[model samples]
Target: MLPAVAVAAVAAVAVAVAVAVPALRHRLVRSALRRAGGRYRRRLEALSSDVRLNQERRLRRLLRAGTGTGTGTAGGWEEFQQRHPLGQPCREEAPEDAVPPLWLWALLPGCWDCDPRLQGSLLYLDALGTAFPRALSRRGTALLHWTPGCPRAPAGWPLPTLYCTPAAAGTVPSRAAALRLQLLFALRQRELHVLEAGLAAELHDALVALRTEWPQLARELALGRLSPQPGLPEEVQRQLQALLAPDAARAAELRAECARGFEGILQRLWPQLEVVVVRMVHGSERLYCNSLLQAECQGLPFYCPFYQAAGALLGVNLWPAEPEPRFLLCPDWAFCEFLPCLANKEPQTVLLDELWEGREYRLVVTAQPGEYRCRTGEVLKVTGFHKQCPVVEPVRRESQTLSVRGEDIPEEQFCQSLCRTLRTWPGARLIDYACVESSLLGDFSGPCAPHYEVFMELQGLRDLSEGQRYKLDQCLQEDFPIYKSFRFKGSIGPLRLHLVRPGTFTRLREALGSPRPMPRVLHQEQLLQLVQGSIIS
Candidate 1:
């Protein structure tokens, strides 16, 4: 009777234990992970602390040595501002002054790569070099970079990105072709992850296009090796054939049946995606975090400042060290000063304190020891301080102002208006846009006064109504009171919106040539062919 009682008690305990296991498993695992993540962050913070402390004092020492003047680098941040006045290019010379100060090239120190004048690039590259080894493996970074066309020759560095004029030549067609190429890459190297692109806008556009029209492409974008296919689709077959020639094609010929990347992207969840390497976010958005629409979809971003030259990296978005990329500025190289009056030909400048936060300033670069402080015309806003280094981000260019009637509308605000207008206009995604001052067209004596003329390139948008055009003006008026006041006083005419031919911007850039993309406020009359010709009755 006692043995029978013992067996019955043992069975009861076993049943209770089984019931507890299901509820306790996930809680136990999550608690352990939270503790581990906390320890990792604490360790990283300690390592960065010392580097953060030395940034300011070291920057002053370098400037003193480069300038060769003890007093030039002396004094508080405010005193430094008093010593060097702002330097701006001549208004008549627009883009000509915007070019590199090549004349000062002979005077700068530290070779071309390490020049004191080119401090922005120096700090940027230094940060990247230090972090690259830690964040990535030398075996392969798993960089999934995109190209406009396929190369005739195999690329060794940055992997020759091969893309060409699409079987069709328009922007949408070109992007569609490139999307297929990326999918082909995704098919190889199962464990490899990280899709890269030059601009965030381009990558976002490509993915959106793929998901909308050719979602069947997902099974191919999966992280797996080449599979037995009845046949490759004729649309993207040739490009894939050219790219994935078997036997570990070149670079270790990483061959694996990689089928898992975009499968859940459109349907369910994408927890596996690592990071999307984006070189720069455009001026359409103020902060990098807010700008990356692609990152919102499931990918982390490896953000870098705009310059692409070797060793010219600036801005900090240290990936693994910081959980999510900060995309914060607060560079240790040069200082920034607020432009007292952007309208004045001679505006005094005041250097921002290295520790100052929550203020906007024009970047006053200390370039070429002998040269005056360059008023880079780049407006940067200091959001907060990471120790002594003030965290900042590029706000907009002073040159992006459309101030024909003293109602200076900055690029950010103009973009805001554009954003509002696009939401109401169905099926239009921006390809590019250029703002033209109405006075540039020599119609000052017309029934209307000087105003803004916008030439835009769009995908999936063919027709625009007068009411739709006026909506932009309404948005602008709501955003900028000065602009509204000008319209009320009849000093500014109604804003004109023009939809240009496909590839209009591609041709415009080709015509403008390299190194000099005339400011947003276009002036050259000859450059207005497609723009003016697109005017509707």
Candidate 2:
């Protein structure tokens, strides 16, 4: 072993290399990119004016229309229940495909008064056919899902186009990655076209730079030459092997190196823009990934697993759909049997046995659409009735609940406690949260009981003093009766709270590289990985 002084010197040098080198590299790259990016940004801004105007106009129209409309009992679940209120042992089953009249379906968002379910709703014509004034592409299949009454295209507006490279959907993550990348590419191209031709010169130049780098960068990414990074999209993955060389001893190290390299390339290539990112959740449903601005800066409301539920309920009263054409609950949720939701304040699980006029159960639905007793896994608190129609606010997912030592703590309650705790401290906000069963419980020799380690990201606050932490603990206990009982009875240990830096959730999600939504609760191994990856303890 080296002398203590020598060891200390070596440690200092290693730390310097790890931190200083990255900082230096970032500074250099930023300077280089800024020189070229300035012109590009200016040009893009000029081109985007028309698109912005168009978007503004459309938004105004939507807001006006939404505000003008009222939610009626004509299309709500309660109304359906009034028609067929019970699920009996021998009663005739409602048809799974039971949809409201065509006129009603036309009222849906993006429906634009046109029936989307009708045969030949989309018209696919050959480019060489009489409909085409000029050929747009060399060769490819096309598909269109047409809706009427969408903001009418300007006179000179062109038809939309989507180009996809077919790939096998072997797993959810793989499928999601492919779809996301393709969609992202399509969006960039669409936005590029939306800008004014004269103002797009600088942007066009930037694209030229992109065009030059993309091919080589993509190739390097595919071959693991750029970086041995993980979580790269399928477009780049298709060119290379999924994993590094088959050496178990160094696999983790090699993969980490690759992931770093891929990240570096992405930072260099991806344009910085103020935009919201969304990913598909469970088929066609879209969910937003909390933006960096929302999480770290403004603390604007964004959907987390818990928030998804909490917000829905708040929406019922605060953003009532009735008397406001804009607000809707399950606007597209038709032809389904609602089943298996829980209460807002309790853990009692309810089955979709029947519908009463004013009672709200969890929104479980069974319909000819696909499955039976399929719990949408959502909780709903019913508001009032529009006629016999049920107006419900979404609560949270049943899967978000955590159970240990007979104590069940729902994610919604967890969020409520977190928000309540933060509210007491002005300027603080809760960004994201997760919990894991404590692995250290085994270290205690006498009457050891497992507990939870709660991890959270807070904006505009740091250094959670003991008193503040205690307040948080008390709030949690107050919110969860079972948890409080478990804690008092010595069935569980004191809750451990960990404050992580802002954007920690974003990093975790990116590291996970899955198209699936980030989970609100993590198991032991997952939690360990998250802690390891986090920016701060």
Candidate 3:
């Protein structure tokens, strides 16, 4: 009986195992097939088909939307794939009816490695959407590349699409192109709201001021009469007329006053426009202008004081132009041609004995228009009809010395002393100087040489006189006599003074002694010059 029971139990266990093993294996096979098949393959295939269908429908819709049918649908599939290759379906956001109609498509090509200036301008455009909703609504959609190194479709791009080179993108030209596109779009769309009320008001005020100051020019412009150039817009023509009036006497007086006023205004506005102009021309705007004018003048002319003032405000030096010797009536196009030439000319000129102190002098060569100018009532002598003569001023030399100690002084203390000393010197007005650790000085373990060097730069000289140089020398000598040797070097007409040795703390204290109502004036007459002795020869 026990043996029978054991056999029956073993049979029962075998039967259960046979049933469970097959069921488990079947389940495992099914999971393995699913895993090997690819999780997203089916889904992606379905999505791709839907995307292709939608794209086909969109192409048809786009064709129907246009007044004329498209030429053909060749390469349509490839084009669609290029745009949406991943087969990702665009989300269906409400029906097309839910969104406003698109009036314009702002198609932008790849902007990889765009310039910072262009980026800033694009941001400005983005900001404009807030100010002018209609300008950037469904009517206008800014389309930029979603991926790097992808080119935008030329066909889908809105009319008057701005095609910028990868190199030019994020540059001044890009910004200018954007501005032009916006302006044109606004005009075409009849969306004047893009020009906010405040901006319009400001523009209106500017126009009014211009007209009031230049009534005759304004009248000519309004009348559509060509005061200078027939091709120029009347407003621009009027501006030119005001700038280059035929009446030499009146024009001179007006220009002088305008220059003074413009200078003041530019001091405030230059910061904004500098980047604007730079980006518009790419880096080549000035270069292009210079090339154009090279044949006519050796350099550009300093004709536009307004632009100069703007440059000043931006903290940039305007390209110096050749001065006009005797005023002559030239065509407007000639004037335009002259501007670029001056911008490319060298700013510094060596004074020859013949040219120095002469009432009329020739520029090193021909100059660009709106670039060269005589210092205060100075005149240029025109040798030929288009020749430019610049009034050369006497070359002035000024110097200053700074003393440094053999040991590196605390940065704060050094800065304070330097500032104090600079404030005292008349000719040595500080023009943005800084102190950085110099490897040369740091390596110099000598008793006299310091671990760091203090560099000083001066600008806006009242006059380059021997007296001024002497005064600067005396100030430095008296302040820090330890660093007796001084070295001077720099580009342009500005002077640089470097005291070679470590300055004494006590000497610096003496220089800063007592505060007075006004700082002591370092006069030109106070400088001492080093004389070469017979023994040296």
Candidate 4:
């Protein structure tokens, strides 16, 4: 009889424990809901409008009613989910009734919650005032980023789109700004191509016309010879000065001209679209090398100060100790799905389908108005994941390498070595530089069959000494293991460094029929082209 009693007691205790556990869980969940509900109420009270306050109150009620542990609450939540599913229509023309339920709204970008209509499009504008008409034309939904100084959006911009702009009339809160600028560049690649081509042609034609007028200068440019000029004409000197010196003012003027030209095109293309301007504390948005929309300028990857700033604003560390220079985020991952590798083991077989989110790969992208699997030649590392999207950092270019036999020195490694060495010389600024294979020039032949020549445009030359140069060489050897081995074996000659004028790179770009910044790794063929175009002193 005692044994029977013990068994019954144990069974009763087990049943009690099961009931108690569920009760405890219910109590905790309710406690959490109450706290959340209170916080939402406090936030709601801060709203300046009765309508918004009422909406918040209603939203809170829905949360409280739907999120309880009761059977009725679970049923209510399920019904709500059915009404506002995650896979609901994602189009610009989504109907008014298609607004996301209050529960899902909090998790989305803040702009989406501002208006029921914003369910449709996302538009992001920047200081350049250029909109992606090609991309915009296709999507009804967009997130528009606007700077403080950008012009107001023209009427008839599709409703239900979120505009994340500075604190101004009709601007979304500052907290809702897009995290990456690559989304803008990638989405608007079509427009970027048009602009890049137009600018390059304009600049190229202008140079050709200048050559026609100044025949001697023209002849010098054509021959790529920089002979000591006994006396140059004032106009020719001015032109050469513009090309060779770092003229910030002149750069600004050219940038402004390009901006104006782009704006004019936009006005003609879509008069209803207002250009969004992105302003930061430094200054209003101005054109830079990244504006060219290529993956990198020379060996350096495409970088935007705005991207860094946005990351900082969000309290996220988006950059690494060393620059990766990759595309961090794209809204539509499909756009990057078809990018081909810039370099393959076999030159003839260069097409590659995707860059995995967590590895280093070459970048090639397809843009509309007809660009498909265009090899950008940019090397990028997948830094992290932005949700399911990959955050890429541009490291270097596939073409930006110096190879002598099996010794390969990549542009990123060289740049890093240069940076490390430059740090030893405080206050020294690197204006520009170019690297080319020596065999292309035929200046150093025989033993130096495949060598590299680095032309540096350095400012503040006082600190440069023989020891520093040796250290620079040592840094390169250390950075590139293969280079060190080749140097030790005497298979490759010592890398030669020449200090060029301040604007050598700019002049090179202009002479090369490219308005965009010149690549750091100028191949032998490009060097040949420069020599043919006339060497700017």
Relative to the unseen true structure, what is the Cα RMSD of model 2? Answer: 20.5
Question: TM-score per candidate, in order?
Answer: 0.58, 0.43, 0.21, 0.40
Q: How do the residues 243-323 of candidate 4 rate in per-residue lDDT, one tens digit apiece?
A: 332333433333343334432332232233322221121111112222222311223222121222111110111221223
CA displacement after TM-score superposition, residue 509 of candidate 1 (Å): 5.0
Query: Candidate 1 on 1-537: residue-level lDDT in tens?
Result: 569889899989999898777436534533333333344334324423554333345446556767687844556554545665555542322221111332334223322233322333223323443444222222122222233233211111211121222221111124434444554444343433344454454455455444443333434333223333332345455434554434333122211111233432521222334544555554542232243443334435444433311112224443323433344343433343455443357555544343346666666554334434565666766677554445566677677788997777888778778877899988987766788887777754266788888888777788788998899999999999989998999888899888887756545543453223234567677677645665442
Quote the positional error of residue 82 for candidate 1 in Å.
6.8
| Pick by lDDT: 1 or 2, better one | 1
Best by lDDT: 1
Q: Considering TM-score, where higher is better, how would the candidates rank from best to worst?
A: 1, 2, 4, 3
Q: Model 2: number of clashes?
A: 25
Global lDDT of each candidate: 0.49, 0.38, 0.26, 0.38
How high a TM-score does candidate 4 get?
0.40
What would the per-residue lDDT of candidate 2 be over residues 225-245, giving only the tens digit for each residue? 424333454545554334222
Query: Model 3 over residues 340-422: C-alpha lDDT tens digits?
Result: 11235633332221122223332221112222221211123322221221222211111111223342232333334555665
How badly does each model clash, as a count of residue pairs? 23, 25, 52, 37
Best TM-score goes to which candidate? 1
Best of the two (2, 3) by lDDT: 2
Cα displacement (Å) at residue 279, model 3: 9.8
